[model samples]
Target chain A: MAAFYSFMAVLALVFIAAIGAGSAGMYTLFGVAIPYVALLVFLAGFIYRIVYWAKSPVPFSIATTGGQQKSLPWIKNSPWDNPYTVTGTVIRMILEVVTFRSLFRNTKIDLRVDNVKVVYGSAKFLWLFALIFHMAFFTILIRHMRLFLDPVPACIQKIEFLDSILQVGIPTLYQTDLLILVGLTFLLLRRIVDVKVNYISLAQDYFPLFLLLGIAISGIYMRYFIKADVISIKELTMGLLSFKPALPEKALETTFFVHLFLVSCLLAYFPFSKLMHLAGVFLSPTRNLPNNTRRQHYTNPWNDPAIKPHSYAAYEDDFREKMIEAGLPVEKEA
Target chain B: MYHAKYIIPALLVFLAVVTFPFWAKGKAVYRVELKLPANQTECIEDTETMRTSHMQILDHWRDKVVREGERVYTNAKGVKYSMSLTNTCMSCHSDKEKFCDKCHNSVGVAPYCWNCHLTTPKGGK
Candidate 1:
């Protein structure tokens, strides 16, 4: 149901782009105005959110460690996973940022059908899908440099060549296009099929996936089927970059507008939504800060920086009445 | 599960970004000056089509003539011409700097054509 609403929302945008707006108006709006607006919003919102996060100082290191910490000299330590030094932290950050190291260590528990016992096993599918999705998406974004560039750079051409090396079709299908689609499909499927995930899933969780799927589908259509006007697209794209957007003289196909509009929506939505994790992941203390709390004293830097987390004393206060009734030790005989 | 106070300001920013088309109009005017081909009365395709689909036509020519060795292009108007960029399109529009770079730079695009085409050199060589 969450996915359905998200899908409908994206569909509405597509309708607006593909049908409501005239080719000329839509071209100017999608090609120029929305992109500009989206980029501005993305930057502003991202900065604001980062500032908000940064202002909240962590009184404790609170860095989650998955392996052995730097301790006694004789004992071996997993420095990359549980860092005590800057170099260890950098390596950890690189691995986490590039490969999702923490998530890679996630184990899934299942009930054995033969007996009533529970079993734990490796579940690498999620990690694999995430890795494929991000890597392919990044590659695709870089490959688009060819369109924006005049005298297309050698690197972009090389990337383009590498992307379509399989050359399965006449126009040479991009491998990233297929990989992104497959990745998104698996992610959405997990939200629907996985019981725990489905239970906690909200409309917000599904919207980005649906929006991305819409953008990817429309993009593939424009590339392979309709083959929209490339020069017109470049003209619009370059015009946007140069801040001199003129309406395209040649009408590009409607599907291209659909793709552009969905992409614009994504850019606009990014900063305000869960997608902002792209920035947040870098700032998250749990992932970024070195686990050196054992060696350093980290008192609250600012008195009001972070709202004081609930303490054991506070928890006991709220449950004191119940504790007395259950004959457990009570605070002030409450 | 988060603070409700920031919603209005956040929404204002979102509205501004999403409705940028309506607001961004006529703020800064940018003009592009096209250097009309020096000696040509006609282009290979129609003027309007050339403005939009010139790259597509050029790409088609690239694949057909350069790759497939087909040296003829019968355009939509049924005019057949030898499919050679240097002999046909650039012959009259030989002033690549004045003619091509004008629009390309205005829009900030880098068409890789010149990398292989050599921009034809200066002094009509």
Candidate 2:
């Protein structure tokens, strides 16, 4: 991961320099072509990983449980905490996915006080921040769908209309943009402020956050401060989507280029970066598979030439004489 | 029982990688109609009429475009609608550099809207 991140950082710097130099062609290939390829790589690689994990044989039952298992209903039971059955597991999974219950329950202690009480408050700020960042990022993403889709979906339009309903500025106030920035800031700040987290956190963590912050700030600058030519920008964007790369009469300005560059960097960085998590989520086996193996045994279907079954009969044939000599209970005496 | 409790959530989190792109929403575009009042159009004739009417329309356009959803009214034919600033603005200002400069200069807005396109027609001053 560190090596991968380092490579990305170097690549980002190089890409940024190319943009800074005003090489539109380079930017197009790096930002546009690379992103498309990355998406493909991410999709293919992610499915491959998930399928590999699913194919893996877990010969033993190894479910990580924090609470009691459902052995007998008449006996004391912790259904949600310790799910022994599939239905119970689904409930637990829901909580884990939606609320991040496990993260919420995490606790960390500090040595600030000599006789310090174990501070047992919810320590899911990271989880909360993650949830906020992801939701906001996707909200912004879905909202951006207006650029790619023709006759935009009513849901997206409704969301777009609602997002700026506050009518805060000259342009409508997109809460998602602000939310994403704020979320990214909090995430970055957390890594910086927490000594332990900071120590463990590599430049990979910092790089993406900074890169994202850069993208967000540049975008905001173009929208509110730099005042880009919306028509030209849209034209150029639409043209690119259509594969007819015509630079508008006054299609893009420096600010627009900067915004575009940052976005391109993000696109190029995605496949190799943790942002690949976008594709990684679906390929996960733990989330996709049903926990019904115990009810229905799952035998390995693959053919293998190497087979040595230590059946009870075989063991008896080998050791029954010794067992009988030692006067041990045996099904058949040798 | 053991498999259901822990393995699934971990698997879900692990598979989170797969969930994004299929549902990944792309760029969205919304079309809005900017209207020109009839009375305002009637009052303005050719270039001067376009210029004067455009300036009036611009004041309305700027505010609405910025505030978003806030409508601007001009007594063009004594009827109101979304401001038709684009048509009027582009009619004369089609030569982006010369016309855009006249207004942007006064407003003190060095907007970076012209970098990618030609400011003037192929050598036409």
Please give the lDDT score for candidate 1: 0.75
Model 1, range A141-254, lDDT digits (tens) per residue? 877765565545677777887888786654568999999999999999999999988999999999999899998898888777666666677767656755677767766677
How high is the TM-score of chain B in model 1? 0.67
Question: B1-125, model 2: which lDDT tens digit per residue?
Answer: 22335446765664553343223424332222333433444433354444324434454566586678665455535555444434443443455544565443322223323433334444333
Candidate that scores best on lDDT: 1
- Interface DockQ of each model: 0.10, 0.06
Candidate 1 fnat reads: 0.01
- Give chain A TM for each model in order: 0.87, 0.77
Off by over 4 Å in 2: A1-61, A75-95, A111-121, A279-314, A324-332, B1-125
- Residue A251's lDDT within candidate 1 is 69
Q: Please report, in order, the local distance difference test score of every candidate based on alpha carbons.
A: 0.75, 0.58
* TM-score for each of the candidates: 0.70, 0.64
Q: In candidate 2, how many Å is residue A143 off?
A: 0.5
lDDT of 2 by residue, A25-122 (tens): 45455435654565556555654554554556545444555665555558886766666576776787677666666666677766545667555455
